[model samples]
Target: MSRFEEELKRDKFVCSECSRCKKIVWPPSNYCNKCLNETTWREISRKGKLVEYSYNKGECFGIVEFESQIRIVGTVKGSERPDVGQIMNLEKCDYDGDEIFIFSSTVQRNGSQNS
Candidate 1:
């Protein structure tokens, strides 16, 4: 299959479609935080804009705004540029856990340059 198709077929197993807001939780609901009328196992657009980022000591953390949803913490791809506030695509990374996301190669928009 093509690379794009392969990406679409990638299994995002950890994502539980627990519709707590809908009062129908897949993993069982104790509290509904998102408060959406309904929640479904939908694939994220894979595209996002870097909203905030920080690097302390030797660790790095970034927040990406994916569509209408709030920002999510993400790991930058080793192959891609690690600049803060740069828009990128979410690609599966080879790291611990079920799946990891990385920034795409090309930057769609530029943020404030850091020293």
Candidate 2:
């Protein structure tokens, strides 16, 4: 198995498709924030498009998400080289022994972005 797949399986992190509307309600919810219907856990591609982003200008801040109806946020990782509208894939990371997803990323060379 690939490293990503191995890590996912080891961590037992289910994607939880949750809803078709594509909104991530942290702490998870029984119903999707947009669709408001029952959701099922599914493995999401560890890749996604960076719709919006900002920098702390050298100051470290807590995780923050974009204003898009569906938001994605997590601990800022690496050198903060990503810019708004960049597409990237998740890298293996851990927070206090808890596996953290998507350490850092940049725009894919192909220019294709995923939601």
Candidate 3:
């Protein structure tokens, strides 16, 4: 498995950052997509913002954006409905042939419960 997949299996969210240009490499790679330099792995922040969302069979799913760059689709876990653009925290992650991400909202950065 790739480093990214391995990290996911351990419930750690990580991405490759270019050592030369310091750019975050999405679709995590060993080389920078911009500068073609070798990359080092780094943990991504747990906090993200909800970008968009949908429901399937009453399960909430949404696209969450992190570091103003990386965007990932994950299942949103909560009893109440989630608001768009609300702050979200990565709750769980794993890999099993495919990646799995789970998120839950705590509070907005501005201290509001929802946004």
Best by TM-score: 3
TM-score quality measure for candidate 1 = 0.49
Arranged by lDDT, best first: 3, 1, 2
Task: List where candidate 3 sits over 4 angstroms from the true fold.
Answer: 108-115
**TM-scores of all predicted structures:** 0.49, 0.49, 0.89
Best by lDDT: 3
Give each model's whole-structure lDDT: 0.50, 0.50, 0.92
**Weakest ten-residue segment in model 3 by summed lDDT:** 106-115
| lDDT by residue for model 2 (1-115), tens | 4333444645433444456766554444567766787666554455455655555667322232333323455544666556655545555444344435553664445888444
lDDT of 3 at 97: 96
Candidate 2: where is the Cα deviation over 4 Å?
A: 1-13, 18-27, 34-36, 57-69, 93-99, 106-115
Q: lDDT: which is higher, 1 or 3?
A: 3
Question: Model 1: per-residue lDDT, tens digit, 53-106?
Answer: 666555555777765354666665553336655665666543343334555534
